[model samples]
Target: MDTLSSTVQAWAGSAFAAVFRGIKVVRPQRPIHPKGIQLVGTMQRDDGERQPSGIPWLDTAGTNRVEARLSRSLGLPDAFPDILGLAVRFTEQDRLSDMLLATTGPTGIGRFVLRLRRDAAAAVFSSMMPYKSDTGPVLIAARTIESPGKLPVDPAAFRSLLGGESWTLELHHATPLGAWTRFGTLTLKLAKHAEDTAERFDPVLNPLPTAGTYGWTKRLREPSYAVARGRG
Candidate 1:
């Protein structure tokens, strides 16, 4: 029985990895901080099912906050089939801007969403869906920023507070009925955070080729125009 269990575990792990194989982030856009970006959006799946949900990674506690509307008619390029749509917001406070990143998970496969917000002010929050399986606890690791008093805010400081160049969002799942478990790790980078600049704010989605892949090395690198132009 022990040997049988071990073999099953190994197979389950391999199967999980295989499902996530060759998943490359072909398009990575810069983070967009629109003045009135919407927080709630309707996600329309390829199967013609529309589900209303808050942007997974963003906070939507306010009543007057902006809302997002998504549809297949938006027509993302083929390279970004996994990402449905994104909505972001930036608030102008005093002389600084607070950034928020919100995105929906791939349609129809799994119901998942995420949001990230940052500002010179001291506050942060990250939440995920509550589901249980036989494996273990599924977890999403996130970071928050807070300063007791007024602090000099710099671009690098903001980026570092957001997890520097090597930050990532992890989706951890424990073993269910099988001997093995399943999980996914998505590496994220503060690709670009422009403030009071002439350049238009663009959000990039660079999916890693495989789970557990790192994006620190590429975060500082210039974003590929292929993604930017494709959306255009």
Candidate 2:
């Protein structure tokens, strides 16, 4: 991780540390999603057949325990019109699969352009965030069973759905770049609150579920996550 990008990553990491420490004296550094709710659930594989990505962790099949967090992107109140977040953590054996996603508006990230900056502009906005796969690049998204083809869900609706329903996380292969096709299904059962925990979700801490590199996205997030974790 010590190439030119890593150098930049280190600089970025330090910059974040400075800001985090500066803020620690007062409010504490939770950089993003400072306000959120944690939940416990399970990720069950869909019975439908899957096109192998040759990525063992992804193609390996089965149900697993899931720890999740749902929050407002701005750490706003439950009724505010802000991007909603869903971060799910899956652990099988000693390995971990964790993902953090923020709602990309009603139109989804498909309509947005990828901008590299030090703010929200750098954020990846897609119906599903992409990952490296043996076949190529892949992305994933979670959809409520109650709604079809609609997304960036409403706060009230999201709450109602979690009462007793499940969501389907669809994996897609990014062939032709953004032309994604179904690869697998990971069902997120209803979430229940997780109490008295301070775990932060940082994708860089874990290995990619598939092949290829998730470097750019991880680089973009590492600083922010470091800042958030520094709060404690």
Candidate 3:
């Protein structure tokens, strides 16, 4: 964006963030997606030879142990079609990395729009924003490949979705208006774990190798995330 528009966006976001920070000081809890389950899984990146993403780490092939979370954006009731979330955390050598996705349509412009879904299997999660690379901007996306069908909103039922079958999301990356290229896969299955978790994620703070945030992107997200971390 140009300087004028960018400046305005930054100013607006920072102001909102300051307000959120104040509120969080009073009652420190995640203002959104407060309820979620921690998941253990593996994330493997492919060679991506067909359509190279131009991101060095993403174009290479490797696998890493990952921790993830699945939650409703509003933490709404089980019967409602609330926007769902998938947050993945991993490490690249020494740097901790995170990528958070939300339910959105699977298309050109639709990829940037969040949608509501009653079934986890029915939702396609998008990063909702792009990460900057040397080539251009890239967006990451994930979708359930195992078709778990109706995912439960209740804690007990949501945990059950993992054990009986494989829960997998195909990981992909693309430019703002480019074709998506499959670069990896995230498979989350049943493993011994607690029902509630205190782990937190911040993509802006712990971005993947070869991917970083733009000034506007950081301005938009940094505030609320600081509040989430119990920081001002």
2 versus 3: better TM-score goes to = 3
For lDDT, candidate 2 versus 3, the one ahead is: 3
Tell me each candidate's TM-score.
0.21, 0.67, 0.91
Q: Which digits, one per residue and each the tens of the lDDT, describe model 3 over residues 1-232?
A: 5988888877877787887766565546776777887778899988635677667888889999988888887767777878888888888888899889999988889998889887777688899788888788888898878746666655678777655566888998889878888888998865465776677888978987887678888878887787778665
Which regions in candidate 1 have their CA more than 4 angstroms from the true location?
1-83, 94-222, 225-232
Question: Cα RMSD for candidate 1?
Answer: 17.9
Order the candidate numbers by lDDT, best to worst: 3, 2, 1
Candidate 2 overall Cα lDDT vs. reference?
0.54
> Weakest 10 consecutive residues, lDDT, candidate 2?
114-123
* Predicted model with the maximum TM-score: 3
The digit string of per-residue lDDT tens for model 2 on 1-232 reads 4498877876776676676666555556455556655566666554557666555666665677778766556545544455666677877668786676665422335423332211122233343445677666565544343323333233345445455545555544343245444545545543444431377776767544654556665665566566666632
Residue pairs in steric clash, candidate 3? Answer: none
Give the Cα-based TM-score of candidate 3 against the true structure: 0.91
Provide the global lDDT of candidate 1 against the true structure: 0.26
Q: Highest lDDT among the candidates is held by which one?
A: 3
Poorest 10 consecutive residues of model 3 by lDDT?
A: 22-31
List residue ranges in candidate 2 displaced over 4 A: 1-29, 47-49, 105-129, 147-161, 167-176, 189-197, 210-212
